[model samples]
Target: GAGVSQSPSNKVTEKGKDVELRCDPISGHTALYWYRQRLGQGLEFLIYFQGNSAPDKSGLPSDRFSAERTGESVSTLTIQRTQQEDSAVYLCASSPHGSLTDTQYFGPGTRLTVL
Candidate 1:
């Protein structure tokens, strides 16, 4: 495939609401990662999934944040009881081997706004 793709490019919701962000990685890529970027801040690793191995959930901020990837395809990030501070750009990236040394392709990101 050309590159990673994300859905619902932008979202607006009240505080305490839940939001689901979707990402489609490039075909054949085996590594998928989710990150969050708050305004004026850097990207924070959220979650990572590679192959059939168990996902690395250490990066998740809290129990409210979770993600799931099916094989090497699409992945979803779900935020429960969203807070205003959760407003930011959620980014997804994919690599061929899910290795730190591999080059990763990034998606456009989903801008989330919690009013």
Candidate 2:
């Protein structure tokens, strides 16, 4: 129905607080990915879920970050005990092939600020 959309466009939390970011991808899309971008830095892949395959979470920086996508639809990124270094924009995208095949769509990211 709609393109990729993320909730809580911005967030502010204490250093040890937990945060959950949600993403709603386009209908029928089989590939979903999560990324993080620090201020002025480029996007870094965090996790990917494609079809029925196990999610590729090798890109996740640490055990504190995790994500899950159910049947190629909604996905959620969770950060536990947030740290200042975790402050950045969390992005979600979906594509038919799961690789930058020209059909990938990126959502407006959720900005996280830790104090």
Q: Output the number of the TM-score-best candidate.
A: 1
- Report the C-alpha lDDT of model 1 over 1-115, residue by residue, as the tens digit: 4889998899999999999999999999999999999999999998999999999999898899989888789999999999998999999999999776999899999999999
Q: All candidates: CA RMSD in angstroms?
A: 0.9, 1.3
Reference-based TM-score of each model: 0.96, 0.94
Write the residue-wise lDDT of candidate 2 on 29-64 in tens digits.
899999999999999999989999999999999999
Candidate 2's error at 69, in angstroms?
1.2
Stretches > 4 Å off in candidate 1: none
lDDT of 1 at 51: 94
Worst 10 residues of 2 by lDDT: 95-104
lDDT of 1: 0.93
